[model samples]
Target: MEKEKIDAAQESSPGITRRGFLQTVGIGTLEIAVVGAVAPAVQAETRQRGNLVPLTLKVNGQRHELHVEPRWTLLYVLREKLELTGTKPGCDRGECGACTVLIDDRPRYSCLTLALEADGHEITTVEGLMHGEQLGPVQEAFVQEDGFQCGFCTPGQVVAAEGLLRHTANPDIGEIRTGMSGNLCRCGAYGHIFKAVQRAAILRK
Candidate 1:
């Protein structure tokens, strides 16, 4: 009888002791916390070891001094840091022209462009297309011609049109189509957009 009682106690007690279960759970929680904390630290260390460079972007005729990460693209810096949300971010990989901006009077993909790469270069966005409250001739032409449906791609299109007009005062349909081909319009307003550019060209002349 005593042997039977002793075996029962041993078996039940050894199966799952409260102290041991608690200890195991505590250890698992600690391990999770330690791993979680260490991962962020590792990421921070890796970023710190990377190059930290200074950048000076001449945007909209204004020079902005910024300290950015090596991977900081121009679109991120422009919209996030400088509060210029006129440039839309459609495809971050530069496949779409929604993030197009003029660098040195030429259209460039801001999302694929690094902020550091635009250093010491003159950059212009849709917001810079106008002088004071007066809309640029192209912008007015777009409004009159109803060049946009959603207006998301309008900024890039207008900026590209401005660049095109700077080079060609009277671009034919083929030239306009070729020049504005980089920008994409989701609303399928390509015809109106082209007509708007033509109207702007005539207004400018």
Candidate 2:
């Protein structure tokens, strides 16, 4: 009986099959656990290597605290984090003014603005221009005068018009055209948009 048991143990020995032996000895489990542990270590390496920068922005008369990446632009932070998508992105190079938002009540291209740079500053977008259920005067004028064609650039134009009206509540046709020139309309609705600005200016006066 002892001799027969010895023969059976030798046949099913741990070193009999190199691959199967490692699996039977729990080496495969250890390898899988090591790999699983290292994966999260690699994922930890992807966490931000830099420090968090805190910023505060006064948007639409409300204060907001935000932590942002150094490379994130104001437009990205606003649209992505704050859910303010009213500001359109056209050129993204500050030439088209499509991403226009009011910075300190002045028309500025949010695409070029760094999230950190807007700290402690007042910012406004088309979303902020409405008071509950009432549209602002500029928006009302844009609708009444048919100021937009495709309406892609209308938000920027409207925000810019609000900025212009801050300094000159009553701008003439030439001034209105000059003020709105920074914003472009591919639909060739320049004449009507200018008229709308003028009409809004008069209404504000």
Candidate 3:
């Protein structure tokens, strides 16, 4: 009698087997769980986007007051907003020193630094290392020593060299290598780069 009732229900609901019904229920439950897990994250991101905060950044001796998202990186603000393309975006991670900049006279990876974290700090880029129409000593040294090839990484290299020299006015060959170890030259321009740092030291003196 029970089997007959079960068969009758199956016949009434054509194409709906027990297994198919269970599968549908299982899929629906999984989808609900996924939505429940993802909805909060999506809503939080939306809220963050809606809440833009005011930021004050001191760049290359100029002060900029602007609104920026909390998640924005210093690299993006520099290159995209301020049009300081001298800070190259390489690897978009700390691994590549192509986005190096000076924060409080220390070398920092701009790509890894948050725009908010740099608030009220002295920031310097390759473009700031100029005097009117003349290149800074480090930039001139790079040119005179032929320290770059392709020139994509030249900006970061120059900034890093400048920061290195700020603390150590005269770095020996070993100190130069160690100071510049964080920056890389894909063109294998280490020899020229080292020479450039030495030349920059002399020029600064």
Candidate 4:
């Protein structure tokens, strides 16, 4: 009986089956790798949460105060915390310019801009361009020229165009192209967008 039991135990051992052995090893390796990758990020994120600082922003002439993690971006604060959703996060890396907002009267990519960096600066969003239910000329021109198709990029385009027109009262074609170059319309509305810029300049004057 003892010999028969020993033979059964050896035959049914976990290491006896190659597939089961490999699976156990693979699961252990994956767990170690996942821990290695996630532990550091969790530690850093916890540290950031512990160091949440007070941030004040003058957005669209309104003052906002909040305690934000150091790692939070301006776009996240604007859209998530402040409920200002006009700024789109098309490319969070600042390449698409879809999350553009006016920082101290200059167009800046909000996603790439940290909320702490925007402190004490005058921040303007697309919502700032309105006059108590009246649209600014830049927005009006965009609508008149049908400057978009899906309208996802319109807010950023309008904000960027408004910034450009503010600096150059009458930007020529070359200047218009250069100034508006940072913004992109995925709908291929470049022609109408160009016309809108020209018309916005005229309207502003």
Highest lDDT scorer = 3
What are the per-residue Cα lDDT tens digits for candidate 1 across 1-205?
A: 9999999998877677665687689889977877879988678767866766778889999988877888889999998789788999997887779998999999999999999889889999999988798998999999999999999889989998999988889999999999999999999999999999999998777
Q: What is the alpha-carbon lDDT for the whole of candidate 1? A: 0.90
> Per-prediction count of colliding residue pairs?
0, 0, 0, 0
Segments in model 1 whose C-alpha atoms lie over 4 Å from true places: 1-38, 45-51
Give the Cα error of residue 53 in candidate 4, in Å. Answer: 0.7
In model 4, what is the error at residue 12, expressed in angstroms? 71
Worst window of 10 by summed lDDT in candidate 3: 14-23
Reference-based lDDT, residue 67, model 1 = 79
Give the whole-model CA lDDT for all candidates, comma-separated: 0.90, 0.85, 0.92, 0.89
- Predicted candidate 2: what Cα RMSD to the true structure? 19.6
Clashing pairs in 3: none
- The true-structure Cα RMSD of candidate 3 reads 19.0
**Candidate 4 on 1-205: residue-level lDDT in tens?**
9999999998888555654576579889977877879987678768888999998989999999899998899999998788788899997898877899999889999999999999999999999998889998899999999988999999999999999988998899999899889888888888888899999998877
Q: RMSD of candidate 1 to the true fold?
A: 18.7
